[model samples]
Target: MAHQSTHETVDARRIEVIAPNFKRRLSGVTTTIVQLVPAQRADGLEIAALGPGLPRHLPKLRYRDLWRLRRPPQARAQRVWHARRNTEMVGGLVLRDVLRMPLKLVFTSASQRHHQPFSRWLISRMDYVVSTSRKTAGYLERPSTVILHGIDLARFRPPGEKFAAKRAVGLDPNRKIVGCFGRVRRQKGTDLFVSALVEPLRANPDWIAIVAGRTTEKHTGYAAELRARIEGEGLSDRILFVGEHTDIERWYQALDLFIAPQRWEGFGLTPLEAMASGVPVIATNVGAFPELIIEGKTGIVLPDLEPSTMQEAASRLMKDDGMRAAMSSAALAHVAAHFSVAREVAELRAVYDAVSPPAETRAGNAP
Candidate 1:
């Protein structure tokens, strides 16, 4: 697909924060930059993104802009290099340690596992570290600020007419739509989500399920196998694989329940998105699912990763009108109170401030 940046690249001298996307693919790390940069800029931070796959509204910094970073931006001695990936950390090191640019390196880790030696070494070189969740913080080589991710509330919100939204998405307006979104791969537990829905979908004619996400060349076979299973169950029509959508917020509006069925994850965001859209979620006990869900309130966190657990909970919630409605209201309220994008941006800004202080506070030139 063709991508463009409508917002002109910000001048290097004016930027205090330089958020980079080393990987071009639409992964979680890239998604974070896309969502956070505009909000941070709106809050009056001198932030500009670096690298590809970012939206048009986000201010970007080009490859040639690095030369301008030799001197610091206007108000600080050093610019903040915020990296979520190892490659980005390497770039920061090249600019700071090798080329000797006035940059304060910061790395944000979302992984739950202990870091490998090389990663730990790179992380040790950082001026500040941020862990996306408290669970994520536990795996870090050094102390980190636990700043949970938040959604764009204006984009992912409760639709006034839920049934109309389903129809708008070309789904059955009468049926309760249960959706599983994200990349369609085994690690994501797409097969598990499909299996769980089969018995429930067959038993409950009023409900239908949609699997929405990208299926890359490598995962085509895996996705095809999952489709075969759905067809075998004679649920080809009842279970739909609508592929990925740019406007996924509308899919959230059409959902009665959302499921994050990942077997493992690094600080997942789908549950938070669903709740923000006023849709209850049934997520697996993995990643930040436990941290994100308000068990028996906003959503149900499976006690185990078993498909049976997901199946039972999904089936029960689809049938319980009172419970789902109450949870839906509670989910929306919880996100607005705790997980708006503004909150995430503010917390991150705090981290950036500590390392790259204002010009008045600096005693000498940055190292």
Candidate 2:
């Protein structure tokens, strides 16, 4: 389902029209529309607020709070909110009570406490709550499933000419580039990635690490720490921070290998992009890595966060051309078979069918 937001309304509406066609073809059945947009624009439509933490002005079908709210309420209203206490019971009761229709609760990522709480609450309330990672699923107090986010593989495919893309993005075409792309942050393990590079550069001084991401206070501090580490290692010339950019696929195409040594992630989207671009990835085994990188199959998974671990894995992948080629093919095939929209829709359809009410449950509302 399309996530409804002020910025995404147009795209969401477009998908609303297109989704039915997909449902008809994939499930051989008609689909029901459940609006999650807030009350200001909901126009009196019926929507069950998937979690206690409602968006700014959305009408609350039922509210439950699992994640701690980062934003305070503008003006408190006499609204019923699902309390964090005994949320599992409340969710299960609600599932059997209020929302008896087929339902699928999509949890994007857990950046806050509430998102997970809401996700757990809804997992008990619905047929299934789709998480972006196996680690995310592990965090849940209730049953949950994993569905890795897919990329527009068409847009992120290997470029026709590697040098052409590298030049378009203002990079030296001849450099053996090691690219990292994401919103720069410590939790993303930017420091660890930079520390790992220290030894690698001593062996191959010409090799460059191209780090790209937006710099917020949370991330800028981490970037500063990384820069200091690079300078201390006496490899400032080899490490370059490109900041943030919208055109990430081009960066992926230019890279020889992608490095993501994050401490935690819901499901790393950057690794998916790198995989789609057919560039091998070296990522941490924490969180979603096991699900995305199939050890010896798709890409290398580092079991530890040590710089030596990452350096060793990346060095192996870079030197073994046959291994890199095999992993590249496997990466593309894995994404195509499991992460495609077609696969997502099929899994969602099964959940919808399982939740569809029996004749006794539907009564007069039967259609």
Candidate 3:
């Protein structure tokens, strides 16, 4: 049973850890699994993802492998099960408690608010807990290890030529491009970004703004309202709403500045991504913004989400060429030093190693 394998699957006996993406939709949790699982595998950990929605190439176990969870991998007496969501935590609980599977349950919490009683109880049962930021950790009743998210630096490095990168993305090379990317809804503060930029774009002839993200059907009215507001300002051409983009890294490369205008977040990654692309940011004081952004050095993390504050900050940066350039350089260095994928991978290794069996104990056995 331990050695049973499915189509395009890794041998089940070899997997010492399982990362399950219980959800079918590609949410932030799925993105984390996609990005980190490969990095973990390359770090020499025998980890496989379980469930649907992951890329076919990722080493994984199908849903039918639920029964296969009955056996521990060949080398280890117990395998680690890392869960990021409530359904996943419940799945692990049923596997280990109900079915008596040999798994050590681990959960990673990224929520910045208080958890419901049931969620808190679910967390209490984990073998180890991880928080994405100190702010998130504050909301957790149990102690947790703080591990900030990191991006693929090779995929998000600075563009060689700013204007050329802008031109490549079909943007006007003459005007400075400022961007805000995420869901087009009130929750993401897309309206705040637009309101923040309207006054600046109206005053400055040299700057342009772009909002790149999908507006779901639920928020179609919100998107239309924002478009109507932009149309009212007679800045429709200057302020563009480009729909969802697959080549997001390229869009990031073309920006002179980035904005993360979220009023609330679990642990925001857009600001990190913007900084990784060597673009200075104006981010709200939410999620891990304060942790990721070095105020006045790399970027400004505003105390509030007011459009006025964002406008003034962006305007101030736009006018000062030297400050923008210095911030750009500092952003690149700060991310490289503090938030590389390598660092994230290394930190996660400690979490895995803490709960997993020692190598000497699980080395020689096989199915």
After TM-score superposition, the amount by which residue 223's alpha carbon in candidate 2 deviates from its true location, in angstroms, is 1.8
Each candidate's root-mean-square deviation in Å?
3.0, 10.7, 3.8
lDDT of 3 by residue, 124-176 (tens): 99999999999999999999999999999999999989889999989998889
Local distance difference test scores for all models: 0.91, 0.57, 0.90
lDDT of 2: 0.57
After superposition, candidate 1 runs with Cα above 4 Å error: 1-7, 360-367
What is candidate 2's lDDT per residue for 1-367, written digit by digit as tens? 9866522222111111011111212110111111113221233212223332323343323222312122212221111121222343354445335644122223223322334555455545543454556666566666655655555666678878877877888888876678778767877887777877777767765568888887787556667877887888787778888977767778888887788888876456778789888888899886566777788888888878888888888677766779887888888888777665445544543333343432334464657
lDDT of 1 by residue, 103-133 (tens): 9999999999988999999999999999988
Question: What local lDDT score does residue 199 receive in model 2, on the 0 to 100 scale?
Answer: 71
Best by lDDT: 1
Which pairs, if any, clash in model 3?
none
